[model samples]
Target: MARSGNEQVSYRRAPNFLTANEPEKRLDIRLSYKSFRALEEQALTLYGISPVEYSATDSRVTIYTAPTALHGYSAVNLQQAISFAVYNILVQHQKQELFERIVAVGESTYSSVNDQGRRSTKTPDAGLSYYYDGGTVLTIIMEVGASEGYTHLNADILLWMNEFHCRTAILFYNKECPKFKFPGNADTYSINDRPALEHTWFGTLDTAVLEVFKRDQNTDTCKMVVQGGSLDIGLTIGDVLPPNEDAIQDIRGERVHLRINFVRNMLASGSHDTAVSRFNHFIGED
Candidate 1:
C-alpha cells in the first residue's frame, strides 16, 4: 500500500489480469517518484514479478504486465538481432571506446519525470542507452505495441525522443493481434477486417509496420524516416552515436542494417518454419 497525500492506494497481485495477457494496468494515483519506485520494488520483491514495466504519466501510473511466452521469445530475439548488428559494426570500425559505452538496455526503467509531477517515467519494452559525464541518456528505443493503437505508438516515439531525450526510436505496431477481449481473454480479428497490402519490392507487406523515429539534435525534433512492412534500411552512425558527438574518430558516416530476413530467422524458435508459422497463428488468431 502507498500513500498519495490524502488518499491511500494498494497494489494487489491481480493474477487474473496477468493470465488474461493484458497489456497495461492504469492507476489514478499521482504517485511520487519515491512511491513509484516503491511500487516497482513491492511488485518485484514481494510478488516475484521482476520483468514487468511501469509508466507514471499525467498524474497516473500504468503498469505493463509481462507478456505471453510467445511475446517474450520474439521481443528478446528481435532486440538481440538489432543490438548485435549495431555492436558488430562498432567492432568492425574498432570504436572500442564508444562501443563499450553503447549497451543494449532491454526493458530497463528510466524517467524524465520528477517528484513534482513535472514530467513522466517509462519502462521501455526494449531500449539502448549511453552513460557519460555521470549522466545516462536513452539513445535507442524499441517499443512493440502488441495491443496498442497507431496514435499511442505514434506518441510514444516522440516521448522517447523529446521526453527521455533519445536519439532514435523504432516503433513496431502489431497489427497482427487487432482485438482484445477482457473476461474471456480472447482475441478476435476478422480476416476481412484489415487485409494485407502487397508491396512491389517486399512482395507482401503485413499491416504490422516498422518505423524509425530519428531525432535531430539541432532543432530538438524527430521524423519518421523509415516506414514499411519489411525494413531493409540501415541506421546511419548518426542514429546510434552518443549525444553531442557527431563525428567519432574519423568514422563519421557509418551505417548498420538490421536485416529483416535475419530477424525473421532469429525469431523462428527451434522448429524453424513450423515454429514461425505457429507463432503467427497465435498472434493472428480470429
Candidate 2:
C-alpha cells in the first residue's frame, strides 16, 4: 500500500464487496481481526510511521499515535481517544443500547450533493452516525487538527449540513486560540429572504472544557468531565452526558443519557516523557 502524494492506491483486492466504482453504490464488508490488522500495518507503512494500533474501514484507515509520539499531540489521536472514552462510559453506565446505536467512525467517506446540486464526497475526521430504520443518519461530523482553517472547516460543515443533512458538525483543535461560539443550536434561517444554515461550534479543547466545566484550572487527575447543556443544538443525552446529544433519541422514544471523561494530557503537547507519563497514569499503567 505504498503511496506517493500523487499516487492513487487501489483497494481492488480489499474484499470484493467493499470495492465500489460507482458513487451511488454502497457495499458492506466485514473483516476478521487478522485481516484488519494487516490493513492497519499497510496503512502505517504508507504513512511512514512505526507500527502502532490502528483502525480502518472500507474507505479509510487511521493509525493511532501515542500522546508521546515525536509529532506531539495529534488531533486524529485525540478524536479517537475521546470517541472511545465516550463509548466506554456509555457501556459502563448500562447504556449499551444507546452505545450500539451511536457509532463513532473515523475518516469515513460521505457522499452528498451541494447547494448547487453537484455531487461531492467528504471524509470527516470523525462521525457519530446513528442507525435507524435499517439506514444510517449522520448525527454529528467532527473535524480536528490545526492544519485546516476555520473558513475551510465551516464550508465543509455547511456542505455536511446542506448536502448530507447532518444534524450537527463540530470542529476540535488544540494549539489554536479559541474564537468560536459555545455549544448552541442553529437552524436553517432566512436572511434577506435567502436561506442560511447554522452549525454548532464546540471550540478548542480548552474552550470545550470551559463550556462544559466553566473552569480554567488544570488538575493532576488529568481527566476532564463533560456534561450535557441545554442548547437547541440537539437533545441532551442526560445531565451528566456529553452536551451534543440533542439529536440522539433511543428506540423507546426517550432521551438517552451519556457521560464520559478523557485524559487531558493526551490533548496537550509538551515533552514526550511528560506526555507519556501522564497518559500512563491516566490509563493506570505502571
Candidate 3:
C-alpha cells in the first residue's frame, strides 16, 4: 500500500492520471542511442561499475561475464537510469522530435491515474512509456523488474496497455520470467508502425540476446509465448548462450548487474510548444 497525504491506497487498485501541469514539461526527456550509452556510463560510474568490465558497444549493451546473482542497486533506480539516459541521448542528438513525442513518467504516478476517481495515489516499483508525436498514441512501455521486491504486475501491464491504447509495451524483469499473450495480425506494416500486437516482450539480461522473443500464438485474442532465453539471439551477431539451466541465476548475480545497463526509446518531431500541443491534441486532452 502507498500513502498520499492522509489517504491510503492499495498499490494494485490505483488510478492513472496525467499530472503534468504545462504538458510541455512532460516531454523533457528525448531518447537516442548516444544519450542512452552516456547514461549507461553514468549509471555504471555511479554504481561503482567499470566500463572495463562491461562493454556498451552499441544500443544493445550486455555484460561479458557473469556475476553473483541479485546484487545491485534498486531495480527501480537502474530502470530510471535507463529511462533518463534514453531521454538524454535523444535530446543531445537533437533528436528532439523523438524526445518531445515520447515522455517518461514514473510507474508510481502512472498507477495513481490508471484507477482514477475511485482511489488515491499508488506507486508501482517502476514504470515508463513512449508516446507518439501526437501524445494521443502511447507507443512504448517499460516495466522494470520487481520479482523480488514486489509482485510481478504482468497482468496489470497488459490491462494498462489495452486501456490506454498503447501500441508497444516492454516489460523488463530482474530475477524472473514474464509471460505475455500477444495476438498477431495478418496485415503487415513498417517495423515500428505495426499494430499493438507485435511490440510486447518480457525483456531480460540473463538471456543470450539483448532481447527475448514473445511471439503471439493467436490473432483474435491476447495469446503469446516466450521462445527460450529472454531474447531472440538471431537478431544480433553477439555471442549467445546455448540455454543453461542456471541462466537466470547467472545473470541476476552481482557481477552481471554491474556489467549491464538498460535502454529506452522516445520519439517526437517539432518545436517544444508545438510538440506539447501536438501531444495534447493526439491524446485528446483539452
Candidate 4:
C-alpha cells in the first residue's frame, strides 16, 4: 500500500504456462542502487546472498529468497543446464572466433538503460553474451521462479527483452506446491516439511515447465521447450545458441539437446543420483 522508490507492486501475481523466487521481501521501503551494489558485493562474497535483482527505477531489491535448500538445487541445475549446452556447442565446433565472441557470464548483474531511459541494474540466475567490438550484442538470460507466480516472473523475462535488448531468454516454471508456511529467520525450512498439496508455482520448485523467448519475436509469447517425467525432451543445441545469423547453425542441430531428463532430475524428485532431498508428491498422485 505504501510507496517505495517510484513503484508500488502488488503482493500477489497470476500464473502463466509458458514460463516460469527467492522470497517475498517486505515492501514499503526504499534503498539506492549504489548502496545495494555495495552491499551486493559483500552479500554475495561473504553471506552467499544470491539471485538478487532490482531496477534503478525502483528502490525494491529482490532476493530469490531460499525457502528451502531445494531452491538452491533448482537454481544451480537450471544454470548448468543452459551453460553446459552452450559450452558443449562451442567445444564441439572448436572455433577460435566463436570462443572469443561468446562469453559465459554465469549469474552476473546487468547494468543498462530501462525502457524509461533511466539506467537500471539487475541480475539473472544465469546468462551468456555475444560480443562484437568489445561490447555485448546479444544476450541470453535464464530466470527460474520458485517463490513467485507467473506475472512477477514473466515481467523479468520482458525486462531483459524490452529494455535490455536481450534475446533468447529461458524460463523454468516450477510446479512445487506452496501451502507450507515460509520458514523465517528463526529456522530453515526443509523439503520434507513442505505441505503436499496441488501443484502450483506460488512458492516452490518441484518439476518445471521449460520454455524459450526471443526478443525479436512477440515479447508476450513463448514456446515450450521441455516438460517433466519420461515425456521430457531437452532443449535443442540451436535453441541455446545466439539467434543472430552469424551464430552457429549446428549441422547436428536436431541431433543434440541439453537433456531435460538429466538436468531436471534434481528438481523433479528425490534421488541420490542428483540429490537426497526433494518436495513431496501431490495428495493423490504418485
Compute each candidate's TM-score over C-alphas.
0.55, 0.41, 0.30, 0.55
Q: Which stretches of candidate 1 lie over 4 Å from their true place?
A: 1-66, 114-119, 177-205, 217-231, 246-249, 266-286
- TM-score of predicted structure 2: 0.41
lDDT of 1 at 115: 58
Model 1, backbone clash pairs (residues 3+ apart or across chains), number: 0
lDDT of 2 by residue, 99-206 (tens): 666676676777766578866666676656666567766666665434223444455556565666665555543432332221121122222322111322212334
Model 4 local distance difference test score: 0.48
Which residues of candidate 3, in runs, are more than 4 Å off? 1-94, 110-123, 129-139, 145-152, 176-286
Ranking by lDDT: 1, 4, 2, 3
Candidate of highest lDDT: 1
- Model 4 per-residue lDDT tens digits across residues 85-134: 55666677774356556566766767786568877776776666666655
**Least accurate 10 contiguous residues by lDDT in model 4:** 11-20
Residue 191 CA displacement from its true place in model 3, Å: 55
Q: Please give the CA lDDT of all the candidate structures.
A: 0.50, 0.39, 0.31, 0.48
Pairs with backbone N, CA or C atoms under 3 Å apart (clashes), candidate 1:
none
Could you tell me which 10 consecutive residues in candidate 3 have the lowest summed lDDT?
233-242
For model 1, what is the error of residue 78's alpha carbon versus the real structure, in angstroms, after optimal superposition? 3.2
lDDT tens readout by residue for model 1, 1-286? 1122222233344433333334333222333345555655554444344434421211121233224333455556657766676677777877656766677788676657655777556666777777677876667787765444566656667767776777787766543322322212113423343322221101121345556677774323322233343344445666766747643635655655666566556434422332333224333422
Per-candidate RMSD vs. true structure? 11.6, 19.3, 23.7, 11.5
